[model samples]
Target: MYQRYHPDKNANDPKAADMFKEVTFSYNILSDPDKRRQYDSAGFEAVESDNQELELDLSSLGAVNTMFAALFSKLGVPIKTTVSASVLEEALNGLVTIRPLPLGHYVSKRVEKQCAHFYSVTITEEEARAGFVCRVQSSDKSKFKLLYFDQEDNGGLSLALQEDSAKTGKVTSAGMFFLGFPVYRLDQTMNSIAAAKDPDTSFFRKLDGFQPCELNELKAGTHVFAVYGDNFFKSANYTIEALCAAPFSEEKENLRSIEAQILSKRAEISKFEAEYREVLAQFSEMTSRYAHEIQSIDELLKHRNEIHASYTITPFKRSTSKSRSKSSSKENKEDGQTREKRSTRDRPKKKKWYNIHLRVDKRKAC
Candidate 1:
C-alpha cells in the first residue's frame, strides 16, 4: 500500500500525496505501542489529544538535509522529536548555561517547552565510594524528561535517557523520578573482574547487585540535563537535586546508637520467639492430656450406667394407720354377737323340756 501511494511515483496525482501522508500517519501510530493502544481504546482523539504532527515538505529541502531527515526518521526518531538534538549539541559546545547543583540542596528552574536545562554536580572520591542519588521533582503537572551524559572517547558527549515523566504518569500532584547511581563492587579475591570483562555478560546483568549510589565513583564533575519536551505541550517548572549518602560526624554517632538499639531489639525478639514456641508446645501437651482424661471419665460414666441398669430393685408400698384400726374394731364386734347367741340357745333347751314333764305329772294325780 505504501509503494502504491508513493508521492514521487505519482507526482501528477494530488490524491496520491494525501494517501501517502495518511499511510505514514497510520504507520507511525501503529508502530508505537502506546499510540496504538490509545488509538484502539479511544480512537484518534486519544492518540492525538495533546500531540500535533510536524509537517515537512520533503521536496523543498536540499538533498543532503532531506536525506539526513529521512534517515533519522527511519532510525525511530520522531519527526516531532521530544529531545532536541540542538540542545545536546549546544551542551557539548558549552554554549548552554550549566548551573552548579550543590549536594543536599535543590535548585528550581522553569524551562521553556522543547528546551533543556543543564546542571553540574561535583563529587569527591570518598563521597562517591559511599554513594549518591539524583532526582527531579516536577513543581507543576507537566511532562518532561531527565537525562545524564556520558563522555565519549571522541571528546563528544552522549545523552542517555534517565526518566521520562510522560511514560510513568504523575506520582503525586507533582511528578518525581529517582536517578540512582548504584555502585557495583567486584570482589578482588575472585575472577569477578574477568567475569565482568566477559563479552557474553549482558549490560543489565553486570548492573545486578549494585548498591544505591548515583555518582558511583564518578570523577569530580558531571552534568545532567532536564528537558521540557513538546510531547505534553507545556513548560516544566521543576526542582533537581543530588544527595550524598556519606554520614557526618554527629550522624555517624547517632547511627551507631540506633544500630545498637536495633540489634538489642532483634535479640529480644529472637528470645521471645523461642519462649513462645516452648509455651505453645506445653499448651498442646496439656490439651492432649485433658482430652484423654475427659474421654476416660466419659467411659467410666457409661460403665456405671450399664451396671445400675443390670440390678432391678422393687419399690416399697406404704399404708395409712387409720385403715388398720377400723378393720380391728369391726372384727371384735362380730365375735361378741356370736358368743351371746350360743349361750341363750344352750340354757333355753333344758328349762323348756323339764317344765313340760312336771305339768303332765300333776294332771295325772288330780
Candidate 2:
C-alpha cells in the first residue's frame, strides 16, 4: 500500500501511505509470540512494566529425582521412580514414609597418570550439590578420550580445562585461553569461530579451569578433549596427564577464573576504545580538511560564475591581427578585472588563463 499510495505516486491523496506505516508497525509486534502475548494480555503499558522484572525460577523436581536414583544405585537398591497415572495416589502415599529429602554421598574419584603429576583435585558431595570439577589425563597427542559415560541418565557431565595438558589454560600465557574450552562439532567443517559462537554453551563453560559439570555423574558418551597448546604437544610427541578434583575445595578458583575473564574482556574493550579513538580522530581531521577544501571550491565557483555572467552580457569575440601574446594578455586583463570585483580587499594574485580557456572550451563543447 505504501508503494501504491506514496505521495509521488498518488499526489491526489497520500493519507493512505500513513496507514501503511501504522499497519507495518502493528504487524512487526504481532509477529513475535511473546510480544503478541504481552500485548494481548496486558496491552502496551503492561508490556513495558513486565520488561523490568527479570527473576527466573525453574522446578528442582527433576534434579531431586536424579539425586534419588543416584542414591538408590549407590545403596544397591534397585528402584524406578516413574509410575503410571493410575498409581499416582499410591506413590504420593508412599512418599509419606520417607521423612525429609536425603542428600546423597558426594563421590570423589581419582585417576592416576604414569607421568609425574603436578596437580590433584578433590571434590565432595557438598561441592557436587551445585556442581564440581575434575581433571583427566590425555595420553594421545592427536586424540584422547577425557569423559566416558555408560549410562544415558548419568546426568550432565562437563569436562573442565586440561590443567597440565599441552595447552596453557592461564589467560596470560598467549592471549588464547578461550581455545582451551571443550568444543563439540557436528562435522569436520566446523571452525573455532563457529564453535565459540555455537549455542551449545554447555561445552564452552569449561574454558575456565573452574566450571562445574552439568552432568551429576560423568559417565555418558565417549567424549574427546584437546587444548590450545596441542601444537606444541604434537611436535614433542608427548602427552599430558593431570589429577582433577570436583565440587571445588572452595569458590576461590571459580572467582579467580571469573576475575581473569573480566580482566581479559576489559583489555579487549580498552584496545577497541583506543582504536575507535584513533579512527574517530582521523575522521574528525579529514572532515575539517574536507570542509576547508569545499569552502575554497565554493569561492572558486563563485568567481567562475561571475566571469561567466560578465561574458553573458559582453558576449564572446574572435580576436584577429594581434600577436598570440597580445591576445593572451587581453584575456588575462578581463579575468583580472573580474577577480578584482570579486576580491576587492585582496591583493592581485597569479591567474591561470589556461584554466579559463579550458573551462570555456568545455562549455563550447557541451
Candidate 3:
C-alpha cells in the first residue's frame, strides 16, 4: 500500500499523496507497541496524547532511499532519516558545527525541535578500558533522544539510539549513555556471582532495561549526537558531558583490588549471617525451654510472698522510759500498802485478847 500510494510514484496525483500520508500514519501507530495498545484501548485520542503524528514526505527522497525507508518501516524499525542520519553525516563531512566536549565538563547547546546537535569527545585506551559515560541534560523540560554513529561493515556510518527520554519518563530531558569496558562487565558478573547484585545501577536506575554499549565498539575518538525530537512542542537547551568511570587511570588497579576485597567481605558477611541465624535459633530454643521454668519460679515467689504476708505478726509497742518508771513506782507503792495490811491483821489477834478483858467488863456492866 505504501509503494502504491508513494508520493514519488504518484507525483501527479494529489490524492495519492494524501493517501500516502494516511497510510504512513496508520502504519506508525500500528507498528509501535505502546501506540497500538493505546489505540486499542482508547482509539486515536489516546495514541495522539503520547506521541505526535509522524509525517513523511517521500517525494523529496530519491527512489532508492524511499524504498529502503519503507522497507525498514515494514520491518518495524522506522528510520528518522531527516534528523539523525543527516546530522551524523554532516558532522562527519565537516558541514555542521561540531563542538569539542571535554571530559568531566558540560557543553551546553540549544537544539530546535526535530533538529540535532553534534559533539566530539576524545578518550585514551586506558579510559576506554576503565569505561566511559556520556550524559545529556535538558534545561527546557523538553523530551529528546540521544544518538551516536557506529561504523557499518562497509565502513559507512549507521545511526544508533543511545537513549530516549520519552519512553523512560525519567527527568523529561535527561538521558545517559555508557560504554562499559570488558573489565567492568567482568566485575559486574563477578559481583553478581558473589552476591545478589542489582541489575540496574543508581545512575541509570530510572531507565528501564538500560544496557551499556560494548567497550570494543568504542574507539579513541568518538562523536555524540543529541537530537531534540518533535515529541514535545518546544526546543531544548541542553548540556552534554563525557566522563570516565574511573577518575584516574592509576585507580583502575585499586578498583580491582577493592572489588576483590568486597567479594571477600561479602563472603564473610554471608558466613556471619548464617552463623547469626543459627545462634539466634539456638538462643530462641534455650529461651523457650526455660520460659516455663522462669514463669513457674515467678509464680512460686508470688505465692511465697502471699503466705508470708498472711502469717506475719504485729509486735506490741513499748512505752517510753519516763512512763515506764512512773508506772513501776506506783506498783511498788501499792505492794507496800498490801504488806502493811497483812502485818496489821497478824497483830489484831493480840489486840483482841487485850480487848477481851474490857469486853468482859463491859458485858458485866451491861
Best by TM-score: 3
Is 1 or 2 the stronger prediction by lDDT?
1
Q: Which residue segments of model 2 deviate by more than 4 Å?
A: 1-37, 41-264, 267-292, 301-305, 308-314, 317-366
lDDT sort, best first: 3, 1, 2
340, model 1: CA deviation in Å? 98
lDDT of 1 at 357: 52
Per-residue lDDT tens digits for candidate 1, residues 99-181, read 77888998877877667777777777766665555666664555556777776666555675444453235531221222123
Instruction: Give the clashing residue pairs of candidate 3, or none.
Output: none
Q: Which stretches of candidate 1 lie over 4 Å from their true place?
A: 1-81, 152-156, 166-217, 247-366
Candidate 3 vs. true structure, TM-score? 0.37
lDDT against the true structure, each candidate? 0.55, 0.36, 0.56
Question: Candidate 1: global Cα-lDDT?
Answer: 0.55
Question: How many residue pairs clash in all the candidates, one count each?
Answer: 3, 13, 0
Error of 1 at 308 (Å): 65
- lDDT for residue 228 in candidate 1, whole number 0-100: 48
Clashes of 3: 0
Expressed as tens digits, the lDDT of each residue in 122-224 for candidate 2 is 3344433333333333333221123211212332222342222323342111111111222111211112222224333223332322333233332212332
